[model samples]
Target: MIDCTRAMETNDAPATIAVPQDDALRALLAAIVDCSDDAIVSKTLDGVITSWNRGAEALFGYAAAEAVGQHIYLIIPDDHRAEEDEVLARLRRGERIDHFETVRQTKDGRRIPISLTVSPVRNAAGRIIGASKVARDITERQQSEALRARLAAIVDFSDDAIVSKTLDGVITSWNRGAERLFGYTAAEAVGRHIFLIIPADRRAEEIEVLARLGRGERIEHFDTIRQAKNGHHVAVSLTVSPIKDSRGHIIGASKVARDITERKRAEETLRRAHEELEERVRERTAELSRMNASLRQEIAERLRVEAERTQLLTRLVLAQEEERRRIARDLHDQLGQQLTALRLTLEMLNAQSADQTDVRVQIETLQELARQLDQDVAFRVGELRPVDFEERGLRAVLTDYVRKWSKHSGIPVRLHATPSTGERFTSEVETMLYRLAQEALNNIVKHARAECADVVLERSPEYLSLIVEDNGIGFDLSSVGSIGGGVGLLGMRERAALVGADLQIESTPGRGTTVIVRVPAHAAATRIP
Candidate 1:
């Protein structure tokens, strides 16, 4: 109990008093109020402090002696001074204020959040004269409430499904994220069994999860399938942990489920792609194996045909030379002798017919005809068999052939021979050189409207080279295979190849043509035996 009049007399110390019939109870109540953790105070209707407890002194950072006998505004901040007026007015009206949450000032000039409860104080006559006030610090409570609000917001906005369920598989809480992921609202999912979202095939999985959660075990990134409200399957990766209270007992499980439907689909596509790639590789390997076998067979056949062609060309060349020799022999031996005898017989007839003028004139004309006929046949024989060189070699035959061909074709031809010209070669080499020159000149006459041509023969210690160039309207080298001379060029290459020589034809449109042939010294130096 407080002796209000005595407390009002001096602000130095608290006055002790007693109730009329219950002094001990009054003392206990007074001690309880003074020792309470909340600030308890009393003030007159004029807002003057009449009593201040130790809690008041502790909370406001002022001693009871300093607070008592002062106006209630000693603790009420300037901004909250109006609150005191309303509190006093309510107190005078004998009304009680339950929990007026407001701000108060400590002696140190810091504002502290507090909740105030005020009740009217009345004497034995039941007339209100003063007010009793209790103020409790609510800063920690406010901080805790704000923290919970923020956590709730995070759970509501998360993209992954977050849910809490009791150990018995009953759903306790569902977040907005869970609502979106599972296609069920919080009102629809809460109070429902956890199996509401579990597919039939996955029900056993839920049982295992509950059993594991009962053991206080946490499962991270566990892959599973869940069904949505629409009955579509959702692939999810769940992170579930045991939600424990302050007592450290497993009460429920918290699940964080992420949607992995797209990820799972991507994995399946990659698997199929790998399988297809491997199949294609196997097919390609088989195809390549078959192609290799066929190519080998084709290469072998080409080699055999090429060998046969080489033999045929060699025999053809020899037979053609032999036939030419036979024809020339026939013309020179039979026809030349017979024509010379005829000419002689016609000369004798002319001399013996001196008595007959007209007959003698006819015999003289016949003699002249016979002589010209003999000359024509000899020239034809020389053309058929170019076998005049018993001692002529490669260089001499080529030079002489070039001169004769140019005179025959009326096209100027230049023969550029090295100092080794006229070196006696074997009959084969000599004939090959002659035939090559002949063919080249013949092609010039037929296709090349040339004003001049050059035949160059060069011999080194190791090789021989022939170059034929004409200043004619040249052709495109790229279109050589499509030109009129394509076959002729092929034949020339074949003939050169028979003697182990390299042949090249180089031409360009409007640039003239050049044919080059090179033979190895060992092949060109046909050993004369």
Candidate 2:
């Protein structure tokens, strides 16, 4: 009751009885205003500025006296005026907004992001009057944060791997690009030691890199080898930059690596093929020299024996030719005559035994056997000399060969041949090409685990190209040289060189194999120009 009487007495006191405490009140207000980092301003409900603190004056580029009577919308961007109306309406209703973020116009006409809070002011009778608002500038921090997020997103989704490792060689960060490049997931890579993915033989190189980094040296575009999850070595181009901590100490490294395994392999394959071709040329040249030396030696050593050797060689060649001719003649003459006689005899028997059904059946069987024998003889003769090369064309001859090869090997074969019509080529050239196809097909049937093979013969204006490919288990063409002249391959290459051709074999362990033979068409021409 006594407290109520004192409060009433103090309230009833006259306004003139209040003493001037200007200095103390000023100091108190100054301390309160300085405590805030945001701009604090008081304004009338009609939008005129009433008071301004130091933060408000600095924020608006105006002094307290200059801004006091001005519209508070001077700081509100033109685009945000509609939102300002809602804010004023809310403030007039004695409402307060806390931490409302928006954009504001600065003194230099620059737009700035800010968090604003506005509240209504009251008089002694507690009647809502003017409003005080606090605005905090967040433009720089917001822009910085957004830029960082964008860069991080790019790194996270890049195709070339980006990784970060601690000074102790511990993996600190892994991105999606790293996962694709290294075949490792973020969960499997992060917090793991960097040496986990490096090959044992490459640890020394990694140590050297760390030593360089410790000396504040950054490594850029260092081409090296890295191991994949499946233990295969992959060529990589790496750029390593130092990552500094808050105190500017080089604590870790950020590395960007691109997997160049495929490109490296292709280059290596081309290099190896070139080496093999040069070696083959050297061997062929050497072989030609040896053959020439043998011929010269035979000319000098025994002139009489030279004649004998020539005769012997001639007989050997003639013997082979004669055997083929004799077989062909026997098939055509003896067997053909016997078949004709048997057919005629069967016809006569069938006519005489018209009354005897059992005799007629025997005669019918004889006639059928004779016809089959004649067809068999014709096919054999065709196989011996595929005269289709002269009649139908080289294309037709190759087509027949591919068909027969597929039937014999049980592997499907496809042939694509280009026509070289009116281009007269040597019989030897035709035989060499056909024999190479035969030998390649035999090798594929015996060794290659191929489901399908392709034989493409293209005769261009300058070159005749034959490409034989198989999706089969592949062998190293280089290793074939070490195997010291595989008889079949040697024969094929010999025939190619004899016809002024080049033979190249390309293969990788798991990928497949292709044999390409290119010959100068004019060199192999049989025309007497």
Candidate 3:
């Protein structure tokens, strides 16, 4: 009887339905939950955690076993718990919380900002059973948005023009500096072409730069002079970079512009000032040179006049010598013969009157007077004419004069000369050269306590050089000796110049003295009248 009742109950019970399709649907749902990166969680109407997916464990650092039995309020901060309840309450009322952004604490005590999409979980009877939420970590995106805000603030407050352009040459961004530079606000410039700020003539160059940017090229630090709204030119240094899309496709250009008009103006002003300064310096130099030349010309002219005076004085002295020569010749030819004849007569009378004692004495006295007069006349004639030189030429003249000087002073003298040298020099050159040599030798004899002296003359094709050197107690050349001590060097130098030559003197105290005269050889060569 109990077996028949069990069979009757089993027969009345419905057969078990097939569950293969439900198993397949559950597998698909599990795959979706495992694959999602966002945390997908469901909570009961009372705020108990009902479901936790893998993304929830990764996001909150809690596994399903740990979080499923807990209230969702655990992740909500104390300050935000009330708002979170209201959000869940609204979600349970079949309302959606679409992209509600809020901060939730992670299991590691980090407050993470998230974007949450919450909706109602419904039962088969269409009654709300719980709330489901899709939460995505939006911390990085929020930080990035804050960074962009700070960068924009910096660009807006900058003093330099910061502009951006589209690949089509339209202005997409204009900062405060750009508004000041081009006299246009962001409102007026955004959709306008960049060429609005460019001058008509310079637009082409800017166009070319933009075209290059469109081709994915960057122009860094491109310097150009651009026109301002006031028609004045402003020099600018521009750095442009290619703007790219998410896939790195060149889209437009971003540019930073710096105004360098002041620098350029300062440079131009400096250049002009430098040119003016140089011109002034050149003018002053030219004025100084002209003044210097004038002074030199005046000095030269004065020297020439003085030289003429010296030559005239020399001519006067020569004229006086000529007169003396004439007088000496007359005395030798007329008075010399008369004196000789009278002296001979007196000698004859003295001899003939020797028998008369008184007469003979008077005659002897007369004869002595006549002989003394004749001697006086001959001496005067000899003084007027250099008789030794008349017979012996220049070498004898110098030798005899030097010998006499040596004898008078008891100073030893050495003489050296070439006989052939006398034949080559004209009268004037010979005279000047002889005088210069004599004057140099005289200086040595008078002031130079010299042990030895050398006088040399060299005649070459172009010039004649005369050198007089002495191993003497030399004086300082700077000290110029006593005014009268050795002006002879100056006289020699002057004579050298009169003949178109130069004189050089080298002397150091306690060393030696050398006087050199370099004269053109042809200076005194005879010219046909």
lDDT assessment of candidate 1: 0.81
Candidate models: Cα lDDT each: 0.81, 0.76, 0.75
Q: How many residue pairs clash in each candidate?
A: 0, 0, 0
Candidate 2 C-alpha lDDT tens digits along 231-286 = 87789999998899899899999989998888889899999999999999999999
Every model's TM-score: 0.49, 0.44, 0.49
Candidate 1 off by > 4 Å:
1-26, 270-529
TM-score of 3: 0.49
- Candidate 1 lDDT, tens digit per residue, 1-529? 4543322211121222222247786676677677677788888889889888887888889998998899988878898888788878877777778778999999999999988878777766677778778888889999999999998899879999999999998899898889998999999999999999999999999999899999888999999999999999999999999999999998999999999999999999999999999999999999999999999999999989988998999897878778878999999999988998898888888889999999998998888888878766865576568564566667776676677677667899988988875566556556666677677766777787889999998888877888899998888878666325423777777778888888888887777888888888888774543
| Of candidates 3 and 2, the better by lDDT | 2
Please report how far candidate 2 places residue 279 from its true position, in Å: 5.4
Candidate 2 C-alpha error for residue 81, in Å? 3.4
Model 2 misplaced stretches (Cα beyond 4 Å): 1-22, 31-38, 85-99, 107-109, 117-130, 273-529
Superposed Cα RMSD, model 2 = 22.4
